[model samples]
Target: MGSKNISITEDAYERLKAHKREGESFTDVIVRLTEDERDIMSGFGAWSGTDKGDHARKAREQLNAEFEDGR
Candidate 1:
């Protein structure tokens, strides 16, 4: 595998460092954070099979209404 050198601001470096688990590489930390986020929206549906769909749908509707009202 090939890796490229990239530069980040000190603040950004520290943020990633803070998220790194013990014995975890910076690359692993970054990939874990980003990959989970990419599928987070789809994750809520997994709860829908357990009778949580109505609650989840109501929450979504309330959130949408609040945003529409400029809250």
Candidate 2:
């Protein structure tokens, strides 16, 4: 594949370099950082079939009770 030259500030270069893993190219780091294109509904139902939902509900209930009690 052909590559093009682009200019970036020293600070920008340093930041990108910081994110680069050992034995990885700058192109690989750029792709890895920018390739995440998630849908809005991707996280829907993530807590389903888990006790996390119940825990959140109980926490909300406790907060509401405390608010009603003016504490």
Candidate 3:
């Protein structure tokens, strides 16, 4: 594949470098970091009908209560 040159700040380059494995190129690190990222919309309805869903619901209620209480 053809490659393109890009620039990043030193901090960003260091962060990416920290994630690079011994045998991985910068391209490999970038692809691996991003490849499994999920769209936020894909999570809609994902928790329904599951025990975790109930937990999440309870957590949301608690958070809402705390917010209402101005805590």
Candidate 4:
């Protein structure tokens, strides 16, 4: 793999470094900071229709029931 070199300001470097976790590289920090965890397509439809799917379905049903009962 090839790497690219880019220049960042002193404050930018410090901020990026502040987000660095133990055992994580600068690239990891950049990706974690830049990637949108809430993007539907990113993790959407990736469930295997097992544990998580079952729980979410149950939660939705419970929530709907609560609203229906006005509780």
Candidate lDDT scores, in order, read 0.85, 0.88, 0.90, 0.86
Which residue ranges in model 4 land beyond 4 Å of their true spot?
37-71
Clash count per candidate: 0, 0, 0, 0
Candidate 3 residue lDDT tens string, 1-71: 89999999999999999999999999999999999988876675576565446877888999999999999
How good is model 2 by TM-score?
0.55
How many residue pairs of model 4 clash at the backbone? Answer: 0
Q: Report the CA-based lDDT of candidate 4 relative to the real structure.
A: 0.86
TM-score of every candidate relative to the true structure: 0.53, 0.55, 0.62, 0.49
Give Cα distance to truth, residue 58, candidate 3, Å: 6.1
TM-score of 4: 0.49
Minimum summed lDDT over a 10-residue window in model 4 is located at: 43-52
lDDT of 2: 0.88
For 39-66, candidate 2 gives per-residue lDDT tens digits of 9866654876545467678889999999
Candidate 1: regions farther than 4 A off: 39-71
lDDT of 1 by residue, 1-71 (tens): 89989999999999999999999999999889888556555666565453657777888999999999999
